[model samples]
Target: MANQSKIKVCVAGATGWAGSELAKAIAVSGELELVAAISRQHAGKSLNEVLDIAGTKIPVFATIEEALTVPCDVLVEYTKPGVAKHHILTAIAKGVNVVVGTSGLSDEDYEEIGIKAAAHQQSVLAVGNFAISVVLLNKFAEMAARYMSNWEIIDYASAGKIDAPSGSARELAYRLSQVKKQELQVSMEHTQGVKETRGADINGTRVHSLRLPGFVISLEAIFGMPDEKLTLKHEAGNSSKPYVTGAFLAIKKVGSFTGLKRGLDSVID
Candidate 1:
């Protein structure tokens, strides 16, 4: 086994919110070394220039091929969902493990990635929501599902977020569905007159999405009983530190995992 201190990393989407923060985290983390960064728009800029972190002047490349020139053991993907799949696939094909944070990627996308990972003997891990509190929210939802059957998820993100029923919400619905005994209310059917008024329905659970400017990422798992309601909520503020820590954990752990692993909880103890 290689020494832990020698692990090298590449950060894709180095200029974006999560990517830049993750790059900064990698720069500060003593266990891992930042070897490359990829961002089409930010190419030619140094890592220090793009992330505002001094000392390392690693050249940024606009394409993955260019960035791959740098020696790296893992790739941390923070690009959009569509872009992320390609990056992860490419990394795995080249024997580089991946820790993906971009949302909106579907199960089919992951299944394909799994095939590639198994063929190459590389690791691929995807996280819908990286915030530790959000991780706990999913954990608690799984536990709550065992006792309750009537539940719905409300997923909230900024207005600019393109995906409907945000990844976290979909994951929660999927996890809850695994344990939920009774089917949930189908709220979409009753609101036929106004389609926008209704949110996306998952299995039997109705997942309502709120896209507004002030919100970062937030979710509420509402469970109902004969007369009472239980709400498990997780709110993420503007800070990217929480997500960065989780991303770091995922990147560090992916290599040890032999195949495709889904969700941040898989890596978390």
Candidate 2:
């Protein structure tokens, strides 16, 4: 109800590829305020000066700790996986809800963060990718897994992305595992050639991660049955715009719950 009653938000990695776009959108939203930004490269400068966006004099801090001093209602974590967990925990420790837009966070990281969020009575909504198409892909794929006896996931991302088997792939694998067990793959001991070629087994699903130059981010689920097969795919272009709306959605819904929830599907109706 303060500062024109906008939902105050702090964006970490506010100058990065996706974060910058999300921050710009937040600046123009009447219901949200871009209160503080965290970007080490643009530290000590006002977001208005760094991003050249008018009407936003938000300060850019080098660390989440410095940024959280502004007392935001939500902390949007868009930084790298290495520092993302720390930033999220820092915000939760301050009793602020979090919407995670970062990637490459391991399963262990989410477990640790979930515990911290619960102890602080805070909520953390971590979405692998905010693209609406990608969100729907998980749902559609889950349905396919229920009927198909065999399936595999192929995850593609830019070569610079260090995470193997991306968050999207992990999410799909987890969902399919919940529906049924993977009962169709050959045993590693009985494999003919190299067993490593089978791709990493993720919760009963074979998940293969490809790091190539042309891909921004893409995911495909291939389902197979007798004399028939189906493939579901989702791809994103070079722009980060597809992610803003969903990240904004997370900011709106994170305060509605406590502890960690993966994907927008968890909170979306």
Candidate 3:
């Protein structure tokens, strides 16, 4: 890519752990440029000060409205669920494409966003987990759903994670439900134990979430058969590098779309 053709990007939540990594990755990449960094807590500080990018003078703004004053090709959001919907809609209204890395948003949320993006002639790409392995995991689970009669999703995250079921697990359950209806050994209505013990019902699949210390983020899709069991799991490390490449790919491809697209697999050929 030519220097003049680089994609100018504004990053919301630039001071956060994942956001900082994304900012640095954009700054160092020849295909992308960090034009603005948004963080209410770090407002008035230079990107160099907040992100420690020596000599770079990108300004940090307290709000998306202020950040939009700068020219940008894309807005990469890594904020919380509470604000992600507004941020994405604001960007679309401003004629900017978006790549959303935030979790906890429901399918209804994306449906509304897609409508807005289509009306505005912009694009929004939201991914539950950007790791390539996780994308493959989802694909494999979809394939397994066709053959297996019973399966459940288990999502593991750190205690600090607020969402009950991790986004990855939700995405997997949704996709699997579309492919096959889970055959439960015991129906929820007939179960004797506490209903909560059966886990949350997503579509037709049971999704169990676990939050505890010493766990980063992980997910498992377990399938049960008459004589054997199959388990597919993916565990993420503490670092955020696994997400960077996938995010960059989303940024590059989002322009080709007219509305919201979910999952990294959407961009993978």
Candidate 4:
């Protein structure tokens, strides 16, 4: 791609584990340019000092407001839920497209963001899990939902992760809900066990979340029939490479959309 066609990107959580990886990815990509790196903790530092990327001189900003002033075409946010929501809305208001990798946003949250993006005629692509395999896992789970009525979700993450029922699990539940209703052995209201023991009831699917020290990010969709069971699972490694490619894809395609687009599948096509 030519320099004029290169997409200018600002990374919101630029000093974070995932955010730093995204910054490096954009810095080295021919189709993208790293315009600003935003992190409150590392504000006023050069990208080289913050991210350790040699030879690059991108300045770090303390907040999205300061970063947006640099004229960016896209904002890729990998911050916490509260911060990510604010950054996304602000980016849209400025007519800058967004690619969201941060999880924990509810479906209703995305709906409101969609309205804002549409009003500003900007694009926002919000994805729970950006690994291509995870996208396929959700697709396969949706297909299984049509044939199998009984299913549950399991989301696994490190103990440090803040969100419960991981965003991937929530997105999976929503997708499965759209395809078919889960078969219930008993009504949730009349269940014998403690209400909390039933896990989270997300769109009729029981989603169980597990947070432990030894786990990275993983999700499983287990489908059960009269005499058979099928489990679809995807596990991430220690690296963030799995998410980088998908993020880049979103950055490249987000400008084509005018409202919020959920899931990597939207951009996959």
Candidate 5:
């Protein structure tokens, strides 16, 4: 059995945007050791050269399978949405806990992962959006949902982002669903033929997705009443560094979780 005192960690998609940042965070974390790093394009490179850390030569493998050749207590995934599920399942099947920051996983996907984790008695912690601002925004949005009705969400991101409406929007939708039922009234009085701008429907909330070149992730929950309207919004910039601390916290806490857990709020006080 691996010593619980120090967790040996492996990072998947280690050369990508968030992956690189997670590598750097784990390298300096002290409590977790960077045992292996996986990046198909940058295999065999030293971690020092890949992330420019001094005196560290943790070798990078071309794939997670190769990285798994070495022992690890946990697997941290920062890969794209399409690949995240497989990586997480692989890690859980291998008896390693997981800390996931990858986006785009559906609720059913998470449920399936939860079932697998429960059967194996393993732990899987997934975060749709790891930034603290996003977490607080979700909290505020849920609170607003409790008091406000006829609310809608507008989710914005870069054009290159694969998923529409975002995982964050879906998370917000799930949270709002838990708080209360929001009744949406669509105005039947249509002006000329402007119909397509109504946005997508998630559960019961209307979620509109905006993808532009300069936009980082941004989401606004707008609520309207008889005389007043309230707006709750959150914006994220280029650097994903804000998510590092939350991801680290998830890594430390996931080991205690018995099955799949969603959202940073679940594990955090």
Candidate 6:
């Protein structure tokens, strides 16, 4: 595979919504080669039978353990948080770089992944949300945090989504924390009403999560100065189309670095 023009890739959630779209994209890409796929339910079947993409008969494995048997340069993880961390660690241990599309992983999860990736000299790019609009939202929030230090985050997602503070919101909080520590004029402990309404503290930024119907995913960073207020926000529709471009961009760049990196903006600059 050395000196190959196309990068070899294995998709963990090949049969999933976003993953299926990415798998189809890879099938026709001249720059990428889909060597294997991981789909617990679709295992033992070929990609053509599952995704209906012509000319792609790649084997679908039930697990990453089976997928990595065939050599590949990168592994794209678009599965759940419970299993996502394990897949990422296993890929890194097997000497495969990774691009993480799944969310719900905490700061601690990233710390462990970072140590492992750096030790193995493998790259791992963790993207909470891959929508280009979300990328811009985080960037705009980071810029806002530099001066206006009184901003809080509001995370919104579907009612069925188990993870509170969607990845986009968590990533936004992290990027803003890097710029500066948010200033809290009134601490949560001294609140007149229930302190729980004030939101959770994420690296010094107050974060509120909203789980309800009719929302795919949305994030808002509201920054307030003495005289003015600035709100930067991003929203996603039911379609997963917005995620494809940035994800493909991540796959193309994940191998350029050698350790765990969070957010698409980290690789963009």
Q: Which candidate leads the pack in lDDT? A: 2
Distance from true position, residue 71, model 3, in Å? 1.5
lDDT of 1 by residue, 205-267 (tens): 677999999998899998888888899999988888888778878877898878898788987
Please state every model's RMSD to the true fold in angstroms.
Answer: 2.4, 1.4, 1.4, 1.2, 2.6, 1.7
The per-model lDDT (C-alpha) reads 0.82, 0.90, 0.89, 0.89, 0.83, 0.89
Query: Could you tell me how far off, in angstroms, the CA of residue 2 lies in candidate 6 after the best superposition?
Result: 13
- Candidate 6 clash pair list: none
lDDT of 6: 0.89
lDDT of 2: 0.90
Which pairs of residues clash in candidate 1, taking residues 3 or more apart in a chain or in different chains?
none
lDDT of 5 by residue, 17-55 (tens): 887888887887768788898887888888779789765
TM-score for predicted model 2 compared with the true structure: 0.96
Candidate 6 per-residue lDDT, tens place, 40-70, comes to: 9989999988888888478999988999999
Each candidate's TM vs. the true structure? Answer: 0.91, 0.96, 0.96, 0.97, 0.91, 0.96
- Residue 145 of model 4 has an lDDT of 85
Question: How big is the positional error of residue 4 in model 5, measured in Å on the Cα after superposition?
Answer: 7.3
Q: Measured by TM-score, how close is model 3 to the native structure?
A: 0.96
What's the residue-level lDDT of 151 in candidate 2? 93
Off by over 4 Å in 4: none
Candidate 5's C-alpha runs over 4 A off are: 1-4, 187-195
Instruction: Name the better of 2 and 6 by lDDT.
Output: 2
Stretch of 10 with least lDDT, candidate 3:
47-56
